[model samples]
Target: MGFISNVTGTLSDSISSELKDQHLETFRTDSLGQDILVKRAVRQNSFGRNQGSSEIISAGSKVIIPAGTYALMIDNGKIVDSVTEPGIYTWENSSSGSILSGGVKSVMGDVFDRFRFAGEVTKSQRIYFVNGLEIMNQTSNESLHLPYPDPVYGTLYFKFKIMFSFRIVDPVRFFKKTGKATTVYDYMGSPALPKQPFTEVQDHMEEALNLCGSRDKVPFPQLLSNKSKLKDAVNETISEVWYEQRGMVVESIAMTGLTLDEASRKRVEQFDSAKIFADDPAALQALVALGLTKAMNSAASNPAGAMTGFAGLGMAGTVAGNIQNGVSAFGGQSVTGPETCPFCGTPLPLQKPLEYCPACNADIRSYFQGMS
Candidate 1:
């Protein structure tokens, strides 16, 4: 029979306490830490070894399920009973027909088969407590590099570390899928558990970041502050693997130590320098004047006579003056450039047509293909 729920203080006082220490009656778990994912329940009697299922769990036995945990009873290598709510339960051994009852299916053979004896199912009975508290893993030290579309800087490669917290939402699925039956399942310490899902998250990082950059309009540098958007994007990408299959969900994700790669940083600086002269006619004229002074010095040192050098220089000076006159004809109005990325709506700092949209990495060739 499955474990039956018992109301508090409902156990009758008429029962005799004559043979108290002979068999284990009560099962409960001690304090569980944050990182401990699962632990086997402790039988009340410590001195005597439990030789059989009867000695381990008997009729009229009590199971104390505390808050923030789930308890499941394994009988004959199958999970026959479980209690998700926090309460006292009474074990009734009247019938075995309730095997795998209470909406919990039998434990998958492939997972718990290793505990069987010589290819035979044992009569062993035990209860395991799965931690229900939120489990926070260590901050991943490995850097995740992704292409980010910045309004001001265009497309930039961002390098950052990640941290996240998850919790077991379905104990049955978790126990069935985990395979290993350790006395205590530590989420962070598990070799296979952490790597598979985290690697999936890393593999899908680019897709998620693209969603943030394009759909959410989140800037590259603001990701650290916009934890909710980043968390949602990642969860949406890996939900099938982590939530649907594994019965766990990423509750929160923090993107930390965010920075642009060296090449991307230099590109931003170069763009900014060029953008200043492209927008400001006065600044461009000043720069042109400085170049002319340097050219005049080189012309005086020419092997050709100074008069010939001056004559050529005078022609160049006339061209420079005409360009300055054209600038003045604009009535000192500031020169304007291309303002935004066509694909993702990110602001553009440069006026000239680019081969690629910096914000979304969309090929600009298609946008300008038929232009004059």
Candidate 2:
């Protein structure tokens, strides 16, 4: 019995060596998590008669073997007892012994649950947001002091601190597209602009400013005064430009700072002061009345001017009354009020009749009566 056991062990070792020498079996796991075992038969090599230099084989390549699990096999021709552990066994003929069984068993283990990927914007990519606060310096002369630099004449230098938030909507797609998680602004930082600045970004800002019009006409500030409208407009604009154009989403755009040269600053200040004068309530009203009178006279000259002429006249009269009211109001003359609060002797609210004290609830009737 001892001799027989020794012979069997020796034969098993030989069989294992033979199977390993000749590529016999292979296994592969599919993407759907299925394992496939492949078997290939050993064939004569037609290449050269020299038995082909002790052909080295790896586990997954195919080769022929006697009816037994040979390549990477576990228990000798038996079903694996535990599903967690897999066994492959091979039976081979040895020169020393007739029948030999050799096998290997292993517990298949997994460390990673699933494959993952990270993504980022490439250096070639350019990203930016539309700023509604930038307005066109529509003055004919360049000396009018533009808020932004004129690329045509001077060296324009500015830094933009863009803020954007993005979430991975499609992990696979995002990984395939961008390749890593990174902000688009990171890509913009490299390759400092000396010879050729970001003219494209400047152009886009100009376009946005043009779309927004002048500061007074811009709807952003006005909308921002109302939180609900500001949010809605911001969301709409961001989605339209960022997502629709660049496959990105901008959550918000804030014009945090603006700078201009000393000359430009002085020019802007002068322009602003001139604008203030031009937009003075009394001045604007006077201008509107004059324009309306001219339009009324022009309408009156026509043959079918009856309706239009009367409408023009009504518009002119209304404008004139508004101008007079504005001038009078600006001259410290109240439309309807006592100069002082009746009960508290404080300055009364301008342009409205005072009946009672809003703060103290004191009856102002006696005070008004005393004034009369």
Instruction: Find the candidate with the highest TM-score and give its number.
Output: 1
Over 4 Å off, model 1: 1-24, 46-56, 92-122, 150-153, 183-194, 266-372
Q: How many clashes show up per model?
A: 0, 14
Candidate 2 residues lying further than 4 Å off, grouped into runs, are 1-173, 179-203, 214-216, 219-246, 261-372
lDDT of 2 by residue, 71-94 (tens): 222122221111111233222321
lDDT for 243 in candidate 1 is: 79
lDDT of 1 by residue, 1-372 (tens): 132223111221111111221243678885455756777776776656433334235444678988888887876567778788898887664122222233112223211332332223323566788877777754555777888876556788978877777777888777777643432333444433445556777788888888888888886557778888888898899888887888777788887787888999899788877988768878878877987898799789878988888888887776565456545545355323334445554443344667875435777765555453
Shift in Å, residue 354, candidate 1:
38
lDDT score at residue 59, model 2, on the 0-100 scale: 27
Cα-based TM-score, every candidate? 0.56, 0.25
